[model samples]
Target: MSTNARQQLQHHLRNARYEVLPLRGTLEQVQGLPPGTTVTVTSSPSKGTEATLDLAARLRGSGMHVVPHLAARLVRDSAHLDELLSRIEALGLTEVFVIAGDADNPAGRFTDALSLLRGMEEIGNRPHRVGITGYPEPHSFISDQMTIQATDEKARYADYIVSQICYDPNTIASWVKTMRARGVTLPVYIGAPGSIDPSKLLRISMKIGLGQSMRFLRKQHGVVGKLLTRYTPENLFDELSPYLVNPDYNIAGCHLFTFNEIAKTRQWAMETADRLQEVPA
Candidate 1:
């Protein structure tokens, strides 16, 4: 790798944020993160919004910058938004990620991220930084045009974006180019899975409807089998170095989906950082 590219890789890795689901062993895994590391909690249909908030509160108490996922579909109303903001502030959190969520039906008025974002702005207790999601591939339910429009609208309220998991760097690069052309200039944190067992990875992928990406990987035979053995983010990160280093992309850093395997991910990141440092600049 070129010295400039290597250095950019190090910079992006050092600033990467980690996202974790609220489940058993989450606290212990979170406790393993470096002090002041940014940890975003994911909201689940089974666990609900309260669980996400509780996990964020606990993580904040442990000294991490906790950004809880605020699922718009899960929120009850404007007053509910106010209460959620109050709870997050009381925990000293000033960042949040908004998603449309996976709920089969809306629990309240807000059904999408744009509505929730606008509602938050209207309430006057906005977080210091707000994040919204981006999809490089076409969404299963929403049209490509709708996704673009929603992102453009949400960008008004958001400070940055975390893209959904995409296996192809070429696709990601193209998506970034298109986004820049459309004038959505928020800094993007590319989403990638952390170290995870292959079976678990496959199950998670299936659960989230990432069938196309999974099928592509499966055809590569070795990649899918190796994922079962031990899957790391090395190859993906290396492929992304060009986009990260190039000034035009505005690819801020990584947003790792750790899958609660915090210790392994932490080790991998540290080791990779060390490797990057050794590359002569």
Candidate 2:
């Protein structure tokens, strides 16, 4: 954030948010980021619920717009959720992103995102903003029909939908249209990975247990099987640049999956913004 180029680049970003990894070291890194920056914390109870909450409080203290991922499955019950929300509200937090967290087994009775959202509502912890996940492609765990159903339910309770990291803009555009046509009106935030090294990218991808993407990569058998062929979602954004500049698509803003590569991702996004401004819209 100290670079002059980055300070200038931020002016063009009317709406953009950073998704930070919830690990210990990475958490400290994001803490040092510029204030008022909206930072979304990944919610993985498997990663530990206490850590997410602690980080959120810490970020809020830094005057940044801190958003904690409230993994619904981890909440013990309405009482437990109320306590959590009370803590956040105490810190002046106004936003939260809810997800069907990766916990295979429930730490409590709440098992899905809807259950969690409902619990939050019942406990009078309605946040100023709430976000739900949307999958442009078929879900790795559930059928397409089920994914759509889950999305619809989430939409009913969420303020917006942040689509999963997809590498195809056409796929995302089609999915957005389909979602709107189906009456799921939550504005969409198309997610893409920020800048990252190819080797480290694949290593981190594997570390995150990217089941669907790995399946896709493996199926690309004989087609550049090297790890370099892993994935970098910037290509998807390049294709979607047209839609991004269009207002009718209900495209909200950028949601970068940093993969804990904050500095590199910020650099890449600013450079792209600079390049885009140079070209005719």
Query: Which residue runs of candidate 1 sit more than 4 Å off their true CA positions?
Result: 215-230
Residue-wise C-alpha lDDT for candidate 2, range 1-281, written one tens digit per residue: 22332333334343468898778787667754678888898877567777887878887878889888888878887888888888878878899999878888887988989888888777777889999988888876678899898888878888998988755567788899888889887778877777766777666656555555556555654332373455545456655656664556677777888878887777776666676566542
Which 10 consecutive residues of model 2 have the lowest summed lDDT? 1-10
Q: Where's the lowest-lDDT run of ten residues in candidate 1?
A: 221-230
Per-residue lDDT of candidate 1, residues 1-281 (tens digit): 77877888787778779999899889988888877999999997899999999989889989999999999999999999999999888889999999999999998999999999999989999989999999887777888799888888899899999989877677788889999998989999999988876788877776666645666567655566665465568777888787887878998888888888878777888889899998666
Checking candidate 2 for backbone clashes, the offending pairs are none
Best by TM-score: 1
* TM-scores, all models, native as reference: 0.94, 0.85
What is the clash count of model 1?
0
